[model samples]
Target: MIDIFGTLGPKCDNEIMLKEMFLRGMTGIRINLSHVKLFDCKDSIDRIKQAAKEAGTTPKILIDMQGPELRVGDFDGVVSLAKGYYQTLGDEWIPVDEKIIRAMEPGDEILLDDGKILAQVKEVKGTTAEIYVKRSGGLTGKKSIRIVGKEVPMPALTDEDIENLKFASEYGITGIMQPFVRNRDDLLAVRNQLQISGCPDLRIYAKVESMEGVENLENYINDCDEIIIARGDLGNAMPLWELPGVQKRIAKTCREHNKPFMVVTQMLSSMEKSAVPTRAEVSDIYNAVLDGATSVMVTGETAIGEYPHEVIKYLVNTANEADKKIKQNKTGE
Candidate 1:
């Protein structure tokens, strides 16, 4: 059966909810490294193991790594910037925090919350600088910040990542989803780190979420165990209209190479507040299965959704029905 991966978050962190998710047909649990703290993640892992034992099914655990993530400093609360409004990053318009601003240099491209707006540092002063917005979108407070074309020269193993990996080793999590993999070298770096950390058996799932990753997908797949088409930031990286084609290409590449691939982000977005999925959402999941996607991921739908177990049931039923139809057609039975 094609695996159904559900992300664990506020909704499904406890043992009771996790057991319900598993019984309802979630084959794997994805722990997002980007959101929860390390201690919380370890607790969740323990809960998952205990739940798995009770359910009599060994649910695969996927640890999603936050790789070189960039984010705006805390904005006190929420800062709303109007379109075409100029905001200074350095010492002129808004007061800049020294530590946060120090990481940036002139000529560096900055992306706010998955590249909603693109900016470049033109000049820098003490804890502040002038930035020119090459592309403009709504800039909210505490949104994800990323640097474009910047190779983080530091080791791929961050302190938090190391701690998480150590936990994973002890827990025997099924896989590690490496985010924002730029090339083969990045995969190697992560692999080397894992090996040194004594997790050489952990499967690596490379996340394709950038133009660079897409262009060099073959290399990444060769160096890793599986692929995850993370369309969240990827949609931000490229034109929203182009996501379909990119997703198709990613799925096709993975299939041709016999590598498992997962489609993630907003698969059942309506479930965030509602119990039922939209008609189009059902068809979308059906089409993804028809396209030979190895798995489908429900993020916020199962993470913080009001009906996390219902979402899991819906996806399983939808995919199962789709698979049956596909099989009937293939065999003409």
Candidate 2:
């Protein structure tokens, strides 16, 4: 089976909505730990378990850890970034780590929101950097940010990630989706923490979201329980046009290594608002199955989408159709 995972959020966190989703063939739930605390998620976890019980499925609870990934701190709502305007990062505008400010140089390029927004450093001051916006886009809280070519120094796991790990089993988290996983060391750190937390058996899904991670993917596939093709930030790491080929390569690698892989990010993006997916989005999911994806996932489409259940319906129906096609081809029937 091509496992389907949906992100849990306000749009579909209740028992009825979740049970409907589980019945619709969602195999698991993804709890994103980037913007919320694990402690605060106990009730939601309980709700998910109740939903799963009613649906008669043992759902895997995967936590997307806030690892070494850099992000813009809290903001009330969408911040409109106008083109050709100068903005300060690491200050009042968009707060970030000092390591990010220090690693940047004047003229260095930065990509935000998975490369949907682009800016270049104009100058660097005490704890902030002034950047010229190259592409205009709306900025939101906790969106990803990365320097074009430089890998900023960051711990493999953040303090919050450690805390989450310490309490993972208490919340019935079955897997860890380690973000910005650059090498074996990063995966090892998570493994060690899991050992310390006494949930060493939990599966670790290393997220390939950077050029560094892509360069070292073989080791990740070997050490980690599974690989997550996190195309959101991974798309930011390189030219946007190259993302498709990169995904194909990653999928091929996993197939050769006999490792399970999950393709995520915007599978049914259009359905986030619309009841139906765009033809292209449906084709994307279909091809991903043919490309040998062990699983496919939807993020905002099911988490915050207006049409959460409809999105999952399209996701499951489309992927399952492709799965049937694959079987027919195998048996020449």
Candidate 3:
């Protein structure tokens, strides 16, 4: 079966809605720890457990670790970036990793909020930089930041990530999804933590979200339990036009190595607001299965979308149809 994993969020945060999703064939739930502390997610975890119990299945609880990812720091309501204007990046105004600011050069590009907002460094002054907004969009707290064509040196795991992995070991969580995994050593660090926490058997799903991760994907596939083609930040790591080919190559490599991999992010993005997904979205899901994806995941669509169940209905239907076609081709029916 093509396992389906839905990100837990506000819309499907309760038992009733979660049960509805489970009944519709969702095999697991992904708890993203980017925006909230792991200790604060007790109620959410309880809700997932209760919902899974009522559905009569053992659901996989995967904690998405925020490992060495640079993000816009905490803030209130969204900040609007206007085109052709300068925005300050510092601890006071728009908080970001000082390392990122220090690494900035006049021409370096910065992608914010999953590449939605684009900016370029206009000038650097000591610990901050003046960023010229190239593409204007709303910026939210804890959203991602990426510098084009550059790999910022960061630790394999953050201190918070270590604490969270230890917490997951005690909580019976099924797996740990390590984000921004760049090399074999990244997975090794996670594995070491899992061993220290005494949950060494927990699956380590490496998220390939950087050029380093892509260049070293074979190491990830060989060492980690699975590969997550996190197209959002991965797209930011390279030219947007090259994303499709990159995804295909990753999929092919995973299949050749007999490793499981998932295609995630924006599967049915339109359904986040609309009640129905676009035809192109359906085609995207179908073709992903045809490309030898072991599973497909929906993030914002089910996590905070207007039609979470409807979105899964479309995903399940589309992927199942693709699976059926593959079966027929194999059997000569």
Candidate 4:
């Protein structure tokens, strides 16, 4: 059976709620290290273990590591920028930080907030530059920022990520999901860190989000035990319309390598506010299963959804039915 991994959040944190989710076909739980604190995550793991024991099921735990994610420095609030407009940060209207002024010359592209919006450095000066917003969108505080052409050098694992990984090791989690994997070297560096942390045996899930990650899929897959098609930042990285093709490619690559591949992000966005899923959302989940995805994840749906249990139940039913149909088709029934 295809495992159903549900993201645990405030909705499914309590013992009672987790038990209900497990009964509803949540075989695995994903703990997003980006949001919850380390102590809280440990507490969640304890509750999940207790719940799993009570339900007589072994639920695999996947601890997500926040990689070298670049984000906009502290913003005042939600700031909206218009097309062909520029916002001044640190006394300059540049697309990226002033630190890169020396590295970036004219016509250098800058990716801001997980590559949602694009910009180019039109001119450069001392510690500042004039950048044209190539793409337009709302700019929020702490969204990931990146330089398109220039390789921003950062450690594979951040300080917080190391602490989180250590906690996961001490707690005996089943796996680790490395986010924003850029290349094989990134995976190896993370693996080395895990070894240093004495977590060499834990399974690693390489998340393909950026263009670089997609380009290096085969190498990344070879270095990790599994792959997660994390479309949230991926959509932000590329045009949203290109996500389907990327999803199919990732699924194919994982299958060829015999590695588990999961499809994640907004599988049930509507369910975040409603107990029911939209027809499109249902089709999305069904299609991911049809595409040979080993597992489908519900992020906000099970995280902060209004009807978390209902969302899980719906996903379980949808995936179960889809799996049956696929098997039947294969059997020529």
Candidate 5:
């Protein structure tokens, strides 16, 4: 069966929602740790396992770990940037790490919200820098920022991740999804850390999100239990039009290496606001299964969407269609 995973958040965090999801074909739950602390997630984890038992289905827990991904700091609401306006980090905008901020040179391009908004550096002054907006755009705050032509230095596992690792085994987490995993070294480092924390059995799912991860994809395929094409941030690394090609290449390589792979992002994006999904969303999920995805996931749609369960219904139905076609071909029916 296609393992359908839903992201656990405010909308579906209780025992009832967890049991309801499993009853409707969900196979696992993904708890994202980017915003919340690991220890803070303990209650949710315990509740999930208990809910699984109550539902009579053993759903695996997938912890989404923040790894080496740089993101901008927060603001009240939508901060609008006009052309020729100045951006003073820590004042007008919250600052990211100095390492990432200092890496940008004058005239260097910076893409925010996955390249939807663009900014350029005009000057750098200590921890503060002034930026010139290429065009007028609005930033909703705390989105991932990509610096063009520079590699922002970040460690494989964060300090909080290490702190949380001490009890991953005790909690019995089935998998940990590492984001921005560029090469084999990241996989090894995370694996070593997990073992040191006494969670040697925890599976590693590599999230291929940047150009660096895609270029060095082969080096880490063997180390990863699952290869996830993070289509959202991955596209920001290169031209957006090339994303489909990049997604296919990664999925193809994973298949060649006999690795379980998945294509994520925007599978049911429309359903986040509407009860119904678009035709394109249906096709995207169907094609992902046909491309040999061992599992498919719904992130925001299940975590915070208005139609959480409906999103799963759409995803499961599409995956089932792919399975039916495959069975027919194998049996010549």
Candidate 6:
């Protein structure tokens, strides 16, 4: 089945909307743990189960862990600056954590807010790293920070993730998605943690979001319950123009391995603003299905969209059409 998934957020947080989405073809709800706490999402989780019962559908709850990804710590507000001024991230001037202050070095390129803001480190002094903003953008608090050609030196699972896993069974969470899975070892670490937490029943979806994860893909495919093509960070890892092709290649590999895979990120980006999706968004979902994706997902569209139901309508319509085409091609009619 071409399962349709939507991320739960403010726009579609009510039981009625959740039931509508469930009835309309949303088979799963992804709670992005990067921005929200697991306990904070308990109400929504309860609503999801309630909505599923109302819709008469057994929708799965998927919690996406923050993993070892490095992100900028909280800032009081937007820090705007012109290009060329030297600034240090995570320093008293920048407001990020000390780990960022230490792990980065001169000549390293740091992309903040998913590459929207670019800073080139010039030097690392005590607690401060001098840098220039190559690409100018506002530094929003708690946003993602990606260092080109390097990985953050954090544990595989965050402390919050460990605590959440301990309560996964209690929450009826059936699935777990680990972002930035570098290899089998990363998956094993999460798996072992889940087992220890008595959440052995939680199916793990290993997200391939970076070059390291892609290079070591084969080493972890069999160990994961499913594969998630998280193109948001994948786009950051590689050239944006190359992302579509990479999505197909990864989805194709999953098909060959007999593992269910999902294509996520910006499938209906325009829907996050407008009631209708761009033609390119429709084609993107179609191609992902054609590329052998078992599921197609949307995050921002449903999470913060003005037209959440409309977005799901388009997703289900497109997914249904592609599924029909797949069926027709298989049968000798």
Candidate 1's residue-wise lDDT over 1-333, tens digit each?
A: 879989888888899988988898888888877655455666678898888788788989998887744545444444544444556874434444455577678898777767667778877777776677777676555467656655343345556787777767777688998887888888888888888778889989888878878999987788988888899878877668999999999889988998888888888999999978999899889988888877889998988899999999999999988888889989998
Best by TM-score: 3
TM-score for model 1? 0.84
Task: Give me the runs in candidate 4 sitting further than 4 Å from their true place.
Answer: 35-37, 73-86, 90-141, 147-151
List residue ranges in candidate 5 displaced over 4 A. 73-84, 90-93, 134-142
**Tens digits of lDDT, candidate 4, 114-136:** 57677787877776766778788
Q: Identify the runs in model 3 with alpha carbons over 4 angstroms from their true place.
A: none
What is the C-alpha RMSD, rounded to one decimal, of candidate 4? 3.3
Compared with the true structure, all predictions reach lDDT values of 0.79, 0.90, 0.88, 0.79, 0.85, 0.86
RMSD of each candidate? Answer: 3.7, 1.5, 1.3, 3.3, 2.0, 1.6
Local accuracy of candidate 2 as per-residue lDDT tens digits, 1-333: 999999998999899999999999998989999999898899999999999999999999999999999888888889888999988898777888788899999989999987889999999998999999999999999888989988987888888988888778878899999999999999888899999988999999999998889888987678998999999898887878999999999999999999999999988988877887889999999999999888899999888899877887888999999999999999999
Q: Per-residue alpha-carbon lDDT of model 5 for 26-115, expressed as tens digits?
A: 889898887777688889988888888987888889888878888787566787877777776554456566887778778898887777
When sorted by TM-score, best at the front, the candidate numbers are: 3, 2, 6, 5, 4, 1
What TM-scores do the predictions have? 0.84, 0.96, 0.97, 0.85, 0.93, 0.95
Q: 1-333, model 6: which lDDT tens digit per residue?
A: 888999988999999899988888889899989877788878889999999999999888999998978887776879885577767665577776677778878899888887888889898887777888888888877788887888766778988899878778999998999988998889889989988999898999999999888888888999998999999888998778998787777877888889999999999999888988889989888878877788889998999988878888899999888888888889954
Query: Which stretches in model 1 have alpha-carbon errors above 4 Å?
Result: 73-86, 90-111, 115-127, 130-143, 147-155
Q: What is the lDDT of candidate 3?
A: 0.88
Q: Model 2, poorest ten-residue lDDT window?
A: 91-100
Please identify which of the two predictions, 2 or 5, would achieve the higher lDDT against the true structure.
Answer: 2
Clashing pairs in 4: 70-145
lDDT, candidate 3, 1-333, per-residue tens: 898888899999999999988888888989989977678888889889889899887889999988989887889998899998999988688988888888789999999998899999988888788899999999988898888887788898888887777677667789988989988888888888889878899998889998888888887678898899999899887778999999999999999998989999889999999998889999999999988887899999888898888887888889999999899999999
